[model samples]
Target chain A: MTTKMKIKTGNSGGYDVLVLAKHPMETGNRKDQKTGEMIPAHFIQTMVFSVNGTPVAQAHLNQGISANPLVGINISNAKPGDTVSVSWTDNKGESDSAETTIS
Target chain B: MKRRTFIKGSMASAALAVAAGAGLLKPTRVLAADWPEAALSADQVDAAMQAAFGSGDVTDSGDVQIKAPLQAENGAVVPIQVTTSVKADKIAIISEKNPIPMVTVLDAGDGAGGLYSIRIKMGETSPVHCVVSSGGKLLRATQEIKVTVGGCGG
Candidate 1:
């Protein structure tokens, strides 16, 4: 469980997440077959979701976008266990979080 | 009235200090400039977070659609579904390079056709941008997925 979170309650018409996270989002430009250089794009600029925090959705991403980036959020009142959580912040600041509780 | 009038005012103040140091140079940099000339390569899928989307007026048709997996064995999790009936609420997803590339922003209050799903994380082989804003106006669609595990690490 390095990073991957998905929760759904109420709307799955467009389909809600069941499983996610299989990262490799490297943007430093590959090279380390032993020792090269170039590798410096961590990913994720900002992400916030809440059940006890109360925000729901937010996005501002960049970097031609692609690389271990999953942000699928769509909730009406959130049922199940009601403790779904996620937090992210990047651009070298480095912050990671993940949570799940659904039956 | 002395030394030819101070050498013509010191040669007009040294030619106005060399034209104010050549107008204070440094005005030729536009910032990285190479957004999407082609080779995108970045995805973590399902992104449409919003603080600002489209800035101003945009309209097309077909309501907007991005049902993922045209080719993604595993760019992390490239499963996305975004539908729209042209409602007046909100629906967004952007994965143009998932460095916070504005991914996921869904709010279809009554819960209707502004459907949405998630699972994004691709770092190589990219092109997944589906923008949909209603009433105010802004609609877009793009699909191109192909990630063979670990976004861009593999």
Candidate 2:
């Protein structure tokens, strides 16, 4: 449930935020080779990005996103020392948040 | 750099100082109510489109660009980037191979330049579609990515 994130100052005076989440991102279409049963869909449904406690970007994702998904966002008003945070909630009702300082 | 300097200089006013002193720098969160849950969970592409955009009325547009690898070694970690010339208010990504075709929906806030980059899992070789919505019109672009192996189970 611990998501890793990196926030860096972009050359355009914005901040580039990258999130590496740990999840299976199951699509429910794959079958178990041994059992031949369909795997249930399990993936992040919502991801929210916030700066200084204010939401900047929000994404509603589904099973199409790859496993261990890496998402990037650009913040136009971000400063070098500001705090950029991300939180995600999956379809299974699991959620976690991670924060990093913009560098 | 010049724009940054100008912004900084213009923001150094007494009103900003007062706002900073009052701890009001944080803007309120603008959560959109148009999250298409049904579209995301829909098993078929057509059904998903119905839930997302009310209809499958997307047009092929050269203005939308999808940047992804021609061949992905790992289906579980295919990186995809999308950009559009139109002033998009929203962007959606869909993978044809996945059970749920709809992958992600991004709400581009007011005056936001349409650009998104994300990694997505592919069950197999499939065409990934990027849809941009501007002024209630949907424009789309697609790219086929060959996956060596299945990314979900294999």
Candidate 3:
């Protein structure tokens, strides 16, 4: 899946990173309108954030997270030219990563 | 040893050395604690909280703020934001009505500010709780959200 992210430097010399990911985030609790079949659970299970290739923070997510999830976090000791990257792996073993330069 | 095998073995070890030098394999483990698997999988709210923080002794605090809509048009995706001035070490989001109440957990390292925003699913109308842990104390804030359309795949 493709993911979009942005990094903005705050006045306090810290960086704020926002990530938007594209996923079904299916809870598997829903049923089909016609067949009434259960939709299998599908969602991002793990997300890792890194700065300049160094891991900084990570999150464990479940079906409770909404589709096209949005996550924002602040990082201290960050600089304007540093690269912030976010990668996620879903329960289905599918994964993707994206990066943006702090500005 | 064969030349092909020798070349491949050296290349693999070289890559490993580079990864270790960059401090990729161990820093995240030290910075972020292990995933609270038991808490996330707990079916009940109280059980989940107990597993997450050792005790569900959460009390309401004005320092914690949870911003969410009073009524959500779609339960599939409700936007929520949490901000805390309490110098929290961890922040957890819980859905009262979902089969598994615990949605996500965020651990804040030293000097890292506590600010998180994400969208979560709600099975029905329920009180969404945001729990912040700081200095061995648990502080909480909750907001009731009305779900017009159920997102539990019903």
Candidate 4:
């Protein structure tokens, strides 16, 4: 799905990594605009952040996350040119990942 | 004829299963066991705390910081940022008034520094709670965000 991500240094001199993926994040309570039918629940169930191949943070999420979810985490002691990656799996077992250098 | 067709179909299915077990396909599939389903589905804050952390004895703490807007114009997307000074292993975000109180849980590794930022959905104005699990103790901080428009559903 080619998830979009960004990594920038915060005021603490630590890397602040942000990832935004295009997803419906349906709560299953909302109705469709045209069909007027309830949309089935579909949302990212888990996300994992890794640095240089080692997982640094993991998030267990639910439908409460906003649509087109944007999540961020701070990685202390991260240096420039380090690889940062974020991957996610949805309720339907679909998964995708995005990786980039820390420059 | 029917018996022969069934045997051929079974053999084809068995061959596909063997290939899948051998890791011939991409291995990014995450098992449902990776998430805490009970906690995520809990309706009450205390129930969620117990399911996630084994206790509901969270106390207010000053070491945790929760950054959010005083009034959210669109409850569909409310930004929240959390950072804790204490040594933390896990952090959970909860909205007191939402149908499902628990929003998400973050497990911080050694280098994570107990920091997280995300956008969450709010059904109405509520106190957004940040609970941190550190050294077997639960510490919490909260901020009330007033929502002008509800975000749950129409």
Whole-model lDDT values for every prediction: 0.55, 0.79, 0.82, 0.88
Q: For every model shown, what is its TM-score relative to the native structure?
A: 0.28, 0.75, 0.80, 0.86
- Alpha-carbon deviation at B152 in model 1, angstroms: 2.6
DockQ of each candidate relative to the true complex: 0.09, 0.21, 0.26, 0.45
- Highest lDDT model number: 4
User: Highest TM-score, which number?
Assistant: 4
Over the stretch A2-94, how does candidate 1's per-residue lDDT look in tens digits? Answer: 667766554433324332333444455556776675555445544555554565554434443455555564555556666656665555555
Tens-digit per-residue lDDT, B1-154, candidate 3: 5999999999999999999997544332111235566887789999988988899998999999999999999998899888888787778999899899999987676545467788998889999999999999999999999999987765
In model 3, which runs have C-alpha deviations exceeding 4 angstroms?
A10-13, A33-36, B1-34, B111-113
Clash pairs (backbone) in predicted model 2:
A65-B121, A66-B120, A66-B121
Q: Which stretches of candidate 1 lie above 4 Å from their native place? A: A1-26, A29-31, A40-103, B1-51, B54-62, B76-92, B95-129, B134-148
Number of the top DockQ candidate:
4
User: Which window of ten consecutive residues has the lowest lDDT sum in model 1 chain B?
Assistant: B29-38
Native contact share for candidate 2: 0.51
lDDT string for model 1 (B78-130, tens) is 77877666663655556665554554444444333355656666666767767
Relative to the true interface, what fraction of contacts does candidate 4 keep? 0.72
Interface RMSD of each: 10.1, 6.0, 5.6, 3.2
Give the TM-score ranking, best first.
Answer: 4, 3, 2, 1
Candidate 2 lDDT (Cα, whole model)? 0.79
Candidate 2: chain B TM-score against the reference chain B: 0.75
lDDT of 3 at B5: 98
Clash pairs for candidate 4:
none
